[model samples]
Target chain A: MDFLRRLFGGKDNSSSSAQEAKKRLQIVLINDRTDISPQLLENLRAEMIAVLTKYMDIDEPRIEMDRGHDESAVALIANIPVLRIKRGAGGTLEDRFEDNPDDRSEGKFSPRGEPPRNQNIKSRRRK
Target chain B: MGARVIVITSGKGGVGKTTSTANIAVSLAKAGKRVVAVDTDIGLRNLDMVMGLESRVVYNFIDVIEKNCKLNQALVRDKRVENLYLLPAAQTRTKDAVSPTQMSELCDQLRPDFDFVLLDCPAGIEGGFKNAAAGADEALVVTTPEVPAVRDADRIIGMLESMGKSPIRLVINRFRAMMVQNNEMLSQEDILDVLSIKLIGIVPEDDSVIKATNRGEPLTFTQNSPAALAYANIAARILGENVPLLQLDSYHSKGFVASLKKMLGF
Candidate 1:
């Protein structure tokens, strides 16, 4: 009976096996909870890059979303660089700027010594 | 005494939820506890087959719920073990045919008769899962060492917690100790870390399980199978016995590999 008891006994293995099991379990569950496939995330990042490029210049652009340890929902982090134009006198103070310089200055241009008409356009757009 | 209703659920299909339910109920019954295993998998009823009581089910849970038969009439007693019964699900009806309120009421009525009421929940977090969970006081989440099963187990555990259920236990089923030793599989501690639930049992993959199921008999009745002994250990734990969890290292060290390598070449 001792032989049978030893054969069926529950002895402790190294904790390494248990640790590996835990790692595999966590990775699979994280994917399952969000329903966001790895392929989908890659596609979403590409689309987000396209959308951001339409409005601003992003440096080392990256979009990362993950689930927090305790939180039940997905958390998002988006890194985007806003376009900043330095004005210089070349043609009309606008020709020296990048493409669509008017688009950038239209939203938030400080009229310290600028023309009144340009200030009027800015204020009207804000309203 | 009132029966303790436990729902054995695995959001992913075929993670041994029904098998665990059948074996656990059988183990409990063998220990002299009045147990009833209920199949809530409506259209895909297989708990009866696992328990080896398919031919004995004259009336199912639906028949009792619809008042077509008394609750006692729907319960199929197991000839293998005394004080053990099965309330099989209807293979013809879908999950929508029964409501959660009716399930809860049925369990309430069965509580006074049995010591443990095990509900074999269906796969997925759908209507069938909800109805099975509704009548359960506690839950036993079964998952394999694989990623998908563990993921679904986590989701089910979260749902059970949200329902204000306490004492939820995790059963890591179909574990291969050799593969785990070779660092190819997940271990029980790893699963507990991810699910963060109390560890109840770890069932090693045994070929006897297939043979037992084919014969419509639960493995817990077999004395030779390690998986059978594990089920009995789980039942003992449920009866408030402090049984130590099974360890794989000691068993493997004494195997032929170590002994043969110690001897001279033939």
Candidate 2:
């Protein structure tokens, strides 16, 4: 069924509505799932900087929650810089992605391990 | 056996949730199954207008929940289809007027008499959505080929999953075959891949849908229109029938041409 549609409908309009919708939906859904709205993330980042400055000397802290290939296991990887270590929790947030974020054995988010998403667009534009 | 409670919801507005609820309920009723569609979008109710039962709506759903009227008294039977009915939402009251417990209890009361109870969930994953989804055994999430609707549908599907709803399905509405063929709109496969849920229906973009809404008619009859054909197919699928989706390439042009030739005796 798909083979037939691709053979006929896939010939012209390779940039068809079908492909556009899929790409747009992927980005939009990933963003929604990640729940890192730009405004909200910005406010959190500001607060994190302010609260951290009150405690100790720190470098730039980047809060990035990247959407992995898997739909459910989006990652929230925060790079918090501190000159001194704090005592309390034994394990760290840095090693969280070592295990599967979701129950799926297949690692959901590549955590800077997988290939980038825009390779297709970049190649298409070059052509 | 008790009726199957199915809720039709789309987190985003203007994606044919009410339209699908009305038409599918009518189609099921036309097929001899007793069906009642509940309008849960109180205050911004459109199901009454879409089903063309606005004139007959004396008692809304809130009335029944509030015990102001009997359940049957609030139910408006369709003039065109026997055994098909509507439980309308209140025009003045808000969605908060009805609780999840009340809605589910109402559905339980209607279960023995009907084969299907269709709940029309309001737009957004807020109070109205929870109230409508509360009584449903399954969910039919509606979305268009656009990005925002798909995004919201994904969110709604996640919410449904968290609520432990089984067999969540997708209904792609306002689909343009030409756009899909041209790679301009999202195809069924693309939507399925992104949403990763089972697709139950794919309705084509037809002007007749708007016309039917204006006339308070549902496009679920055996019409030449593609949208009606899709709805009829969906209605059958909902009855647990093993129906395959329309073979697009053949049904789009070749089948029509062949049927036309047969009609002309050429």
Per-model DockQ: 0.24, 0.36
| Candidate 1 regions with alpha-carbon error over 4 angstroms | A1-127, B249-266
Give the candidate number with the greatest lDDT: 2
Q: Give the per-residue lDDT of model 1 (tens digit) for A69-98.
A: 433323555555555323332243344335
Task: Give one digit per residue, the lDDT tens place, for model 2 in B1-266.
Answer: 99999999999999999999988998899899999999999999889899999999999888987889999999999988899999999999877898899989989999999999999999998899999999999999999988888888988998887787878999999987666665677778888888889999888788889999989888875455778878887999998888877544543466666574343222
lDDT of 1 by residue, B113-212 (tens): 9999999999999999999999999988999988778888888887888786667898889988777776668767667777778988988888888999
TM-score per candidate, chains pooled? 0.70, 0.73
- Residue B104, model 1: lDDT of 95
Residues A74-95 of candidate 2: C-alpha lDDT, one tens digit per residue: 4545677577543432343345
Docking class of 1: acceptable
Over all chains combined, what TM-score does candidate 1 have? 0.70
Q: What is the C-alpha RMSD of each candidate to the true structure, in Å?
A: 12.7, 10.8
Q: Give the clashing pairs for model 1.
A: A10-B247, A11-B247, A21-B186, A21-B187, A22-B190, B52-B216
lDDT score for residue B159 of model 2: 88
Report clash pairs, candidate 2: A16-B182, A16-B183, A16-B184, A17-B183, A17-B184, A17-B185, A18-B185
